[model samples]
Target: MRATVIGAGLAGCEAAWQLAERGVSVTLCEMKPKKYSPAHSYEGFAELICSNSLKASRLESAAGLLKHEMELLGSLLVRVAKENAVEAGGALAVDRKGFSDGVTREILGHPLITVVYDEITEIPEGEVVIATGPLTSDSFAQQIKKLCSSEYLSFYDAAAPIVSFESIDRERVFFAARYGRGDDDYINCPMDKAEYEAFHEALVSAESAPLHEFDQQLKVYEGCMPVEVLAKRGQDAIRYGPLKPVGLTDPRTGRRPWAVVQLRKENRAGTLYNLVGFQTNLKFPEQKRVFSMIPGLEHADFQRYGVMHRNTFLDSPRLLEQDMSLKKDSHIYFAGQITGTEGYMESAAGGILAGINLARKLRGQAPLILPADTMTGALVGYITDETVKDFQPMGSNMGILPPLSERVRDKKKRYGMLAQRAMDSLKAYLQEQGL
Candidate 1:
């Protein structure tokens, strides 16, 4: 059987790879090298547009548990990310270029997978998966709305700015990761207590771009809030949130900084570095005016100023089935952030499930149902449960998983048990399928 997968971002690439591995013919459609999304620039498949870090890798964390499950399933993205990993302490961070290149090579090299470079304006007939990510194109987005016939399906998002490394004042900055971890992986801009207080005040008072009428009605996702919005909650909100500097002690001062702004290397060449968690919606002039106040960034040149964009998602609780198949049309499936599953790994998990179900449907076999104990199964259940109200997009968190048979008071021990249960359930499922 043949499958069509749209948007060669993280989830789409994973779905295509899974289908090809199952001996199914696949067409991977990516609209790049011709057009670009507001946040994406590369023409490559599985581009890591934001931070390269895939969050924590220890089994105690929810993202870590999801990664463990994906690894067990022989996920191509996970494999490549591990091979291209950069030092990030306990987090699974990768060399972004290497990771993207690896995925692009593997998909193009697969004999069963054919990649088409044009943007798909309409949903094609037959088996299909829409994995177009948060920054889906305007034309395709319209097509999706027409297909679903639903309004009020958006979750607005934004991106952080990238700055040229050469433009930064080296004398004012020090090279170090938090707590001296990761060995010079981050550039630290130290802020004295007074300096931080002044910056905090300016950030809160800075003028933001005027929101459009439609933009005003849209809700912002918690994971990607604009810096100014974070500041408005309180004078110290940003200092406690993104700009907090608790780990490192400054060599020059022999004291921990009042606050620190970090810039992470964006490419192997180190020509550009992105503001670590500084996604913002400040007007361009305001971005320069407010951001330049950082001690080291006074003369910094911005390669890309942060901008906000529209993010649309189906109310998955009302639209999708347990296997991520659309209830209205069995042949159609949805994956990625648009399905109300947040984070790269969670989206990839949805893609894997969707691809497997599509393959099963084509083979006239019974659809696979994952046990609720597994992280994969839990995420699918969360999206498909009609009873869930205020169905916002979510990352894999322990709160979504079923509670243990016997409750444990310690948080770490509880997470460990959850991970163990999930793995055991998954192994049994795999054995049953003889996979």
Candidate 2:
């Protein structure tokens, strides 16, 4: 049997690899060299277009648990990410160029997989998986719009600005996590009440970059809200959101400051740090002017300014099944950010499920629907749950997973048990399937 997988992104590559590995001939379609999306540049498959970090790697964390589940399902991108990893404290950060090149090599070298470098303006006949990412081309996006009856949904994602670590005033900053949860994996810039007030006012008053016609309709997701838009909600709105000072104390003042700005390590060298939860669309000059108000960032050199972009997703709850196949069309399946699963690994996991399920279908095997206790299952469950109201893209979080049968009190121990249960369940399924 043959499969056509469009868009050789992280999701597309994962889907194509999984199918090809299962003795299926596959065509991995990509438009990188022939045409590029606004967010893409590299002429390779599975490019990391956003932040290089794949989030925290501890099993007790939501992202880490999801990744563990993906590994059990044989995810190609996650495996390659670890191979090209660089330290970002507790998170898995990869050398972007190297990771992309590695994924491209494997996908191209596969005997069953054929790389097709062309733009697909319309969905093809026969078994197909559309893993095209949020930045899908306008022509194909129109086709998707027609197929889904104009329910092609959207949300805005804004990236945080990166600043040079050397430019920061170390004397004014301290290294510590909130209540020292893990090792000192973050750089904290403290703010007094007076300083916070000044910063808050400047932020809400800052000028923003103009949006494109498509982006003008973008509704900001709470998870990635622009700092300026968040600040204007109220005077202390940002204080409770990104800049909250809870569980942290300023060594300089020997007490918790009114608020704080965190800079997370952007790469292994620690030369760059991204402004944590500081997504914004301010003009480049405005970002420099306003963000410099923080004590430690007085001379901060911004490596990249935050910018807003449009992300297109489907109303999956009403359109897709647990196996990620469209309910109305058995031969068509969907995956990635376009299917309403957010984050890098979350999208890749969807691809894994789609590819595996498609292969199983061709072999006349039953569909694999994961239980809600697992992170991967819970995310898929959420996107495909028909009872959901006003569906929105969801990233893996501990809250989504079903509660353990035996309630454990300590947050860390409880999460650890939850992670173990998911692993055990998925392992049992794999073993039963003789996989």
Among all candidates shown, the one with the greatest TM-score:
2
- How close to the true structure is residue 314 of candidate 2, measured as C-alpha lDDT? 93
lDDT of 1 by residue, 383-409 (tens): 787765445565676655666778676
The ten-residue window of minimal lDDT in model 2 covers 265-274
Using lDDT as the measure, the top candidate is: 2
Each candidate: RMSD: 13.8, 11.2
Q: Estimate each model's TM-score.
A: 0.68, 0.69
Q: Which stretches of model 1 miss by more than 4 angstroms? A: 155-309
Q: lDDT of model 1 at residue 21?
A: 89
lDDT against the true structure, per candidate, is: 0.82, 0.86
Clashing pairs in 2: none
